[model samples]
Target chain A: MQSDLKRIVSKLHSGMRIAVPVDYAGVSMALTRPMIEAGLRDLDLVCVPTGGLQVDMLVGAGCVRSVETSAVSLGEAGGAPRFNAAVKEGSIKVIDATCPAVHAGLIAAQKGSPFLPLRGLIGTDVLANRPDWKVIDNPLSDQKDPVVLIPAIHPDVAIFHAPMADRHGNVWIGRRRELAPMAYAARETYVTVDRIVEGNLLADEMTGAGVLPALYVSAVAEAPKGAWPYGLWGEYPADVDELKRYAAAARTQEGFDAYMSETAQQGEPA
Target chain B: MSNVLPREILITTIARLLEGVRHVAVGASSPMPAAGAMLRRALDENERTVRLSILGSVEHNFFTNGSCELFDSAGQGRIDAFFLGGGQIDGQANVNLVGVGDYPQVKVRWPGSFGSAYLYFVVPKVILFREEHTPRVMVEKVDFVSAPGVSDPEVYRPGGPVALLTGKGLFSFDKTRPGFTLESTHEGESLASIREATGFAFEHADSVPETPAPDAATLELLRTRVLDELEETYPAFAADWRRDLAALSVPA
Candidate 1:
């Protein structure tokens, strides 16, 4: 169904594992707001560490029960207030991992494999903390060195914003290859695009190679500036001022509520 | 009389350390290292083949495959040098990029490990850069080993800690001895102060030399071309550094 933000988020239920692309990768921050505004709780949100305003917004709205990602930080913008606060208070479960682990897990699911073998994480704390990840000796090699294997992470829903999508629903991901793996791994894929193009993206020589086939996409919503406060690659730069303000205002619960209410009134995407 | 900033000293020293590297990749939130890499790229006209892949830069980075591309390249021995930092860096060069206190839950929390664990093993010349030179930061043992500085003899590790550059001094890692040896101290920083601040034990010469200052030509390039290019990815940091350089040369 090609639905709006509210309707798309309304479909989310508590305790669902939702995967979004990393901050640098296209993230639909606008669609996530309605889920927060709806007060949906106990979500298992997954993304890379550099999630900046996107993860902080959800954590600030108290929609996340656990975060299964490599890291969560604001990067150059400074500290991630809500995420830091939640971790400090022991209110959230952090499945701390390395970047490759998260990527391997998703890729494993995409390939329909039980697990994916990774090179590192042998003597590190990442291996110690994650019991699900195991080390096995490389059977094929003459020298038996241990290799860590991570279980497949098949998220319930994969949601993100993209620069463009054609009428056929083929989303153009450009260089963001992680989105391809994410959509393949998830049970359902939902996307919000800056604009829906006329010609089929797969047919165009320039954009064809970058298209994520419509067969993987379940829903497509049109939301301009959807990855706001976070840049959408070649489109526009991040709203740094808004990000800094968010970092400050999200330090406290009351302040977060005030910030969200004010933003909600700003008439974000329908 | 000329003036110098501690941070400027760091950049110059890092550039010197990065000499002869074909490709250096600077991760996000690392302006100083990125600046050092850029400076190296600018000064040495002979090494025009040097390639810098700054994570968030539009112009500097040539990678089309996004985040995982760096890791894949590093694994194949393409990226010669990379930078890593931690909340705590231990005696053996093991780093803790995760948190401070205990596992699962800690007293102090920093960002989680994204690629440090994997890249530390693949990249040949992984420089450990930590500006803070306190016992709290340079510890006896890291609380959590995000990526070990030294691995087991059996482990198939190509990349490990080469050197550590801090605000106080620079230490070269001895792979055979499996320890850090105090190389030299930054100008105006005393050996006594470094000894007092360092939590881990390291061998030092009777007389440690002062780190060489950046020549006039290099400094000029840093203030101009380096600063201009850096502003694209690190606007606030570049602006602040430019402002600081201006303030330093001002009449008292």
Candidate 2:
């Protein structure tokens, strides 16, 4: 299991763009821990639509060089302290985006298209700041109509956590279908699962609908409670108290370091 | 009538604004809006079915396809109403959820724009809700435009702001005029007070009406059915609201 995790991390290089799913869907804290421990640097992070704790921790740990995201928050806990501070200090680049734009970009990549046309953002700072995004007249409309075009966001690696995976490496993501596009748009996809079931997940028609085929999964590791602190859909609820502590401690760099060190000590072996 | 809390009034007002809507979608971290949508659902249960989709709720959310489906649904004109809050909102209804100061290096950073940019243009009745009514929040112009209130004539925008509700009052937006008009003030607020609190210019009637308080039955429904449903998604907020109501009812 440890070897598999190491092998997955080996493929990751500094300055690589990696994509992760949003918070409500299972986020891979297990995978994130190893990358932070390895002192990975200068990576471009893409939040499929939005992000929360995982993005903040990576920014705090100095592993991210740029964050292309719609939003990064702690939900009920409040604003993401480290991420906000980093952006204020100009330590990292922020490609500010709206939720649909992020999804549109990934969808474009999944379809091998150059860009996808989206409505809204006609006269906004989000569009003004993004030089890569283009506003063009709708060719199909005879009347003057304009739309924004979002370029494809092809990440080098896509990572997330799930309830379970079978021996054939088919991962069951349930209704978290956003992961499918992330997996399809990336060159490689890594997943950490709570457990590996005995039977082939794709063989059963009932479970087959929710399964991501092994063709897109580059590697899978068995790590129980892989999405700790953050909740898995039906597994557990988020640790709000712990998130609050992180939110408070992460307000200062010294406090953040202390929190990180303490967290590192308490981390269980993979 | 005297026992009504300010939040209950806001919830009732929300329900009023949401009347006749087929489907209303509330986003993350908005307990008030969720409560409002639930009240609307409860009110329309016998007469008509008003579908409510509160994001981040397992039971209330109807989307099985994940987060992207919300934006997709709104774009297709399936969602009739939505709620948006901002760190800074101007008279023009421009919202700034990104932060204050310049781009990249901001003095104060709030969360980045979530689904606002797309939903504002797609959701027909986008209600601007902000509990904090002050000069700092009600700015003349936002530091950044996370979502513009109105777009160019050539832009493919099917929706825009219909109203702005705050702790102090409710203001209706006229897209043709591209500005806000003070509709009604809350119990303690007046036209002069609202003008003093607001940073931007807005039209107001000579004698503005006070926002109507929730009636006895409406209050009863809010205290019971609405809070019960809201507790599933916002346990702490529900508990706090109940506690506050309990404290209010005590002899003082």
Error of 1 at A214 (Å): 0.7
Runs of candidate 2 with Cα error greater than 4 angstroms are none
Off by over 4 Å in 1: A1-3
For every prediction, compared with the true complex, DockQ reads: 0.66, 0.87
Per-residue alpha-carbon lDDT of candidate 1 for residues B176-243, written as tens digits (9 for 90 to 100): 88899999998777789898999999988999998878889988888889889889888889889988
Estimated TM-score for each candidate: 0.96, 0.98
Candidate models: Cα lDDT each: 0.85, 0.91
- Which residue pairs overlap in candidate 2's backbone? none
Give the C-alpha miss distance for residue B55 in model 1, angstroms.
Answer: 0.7
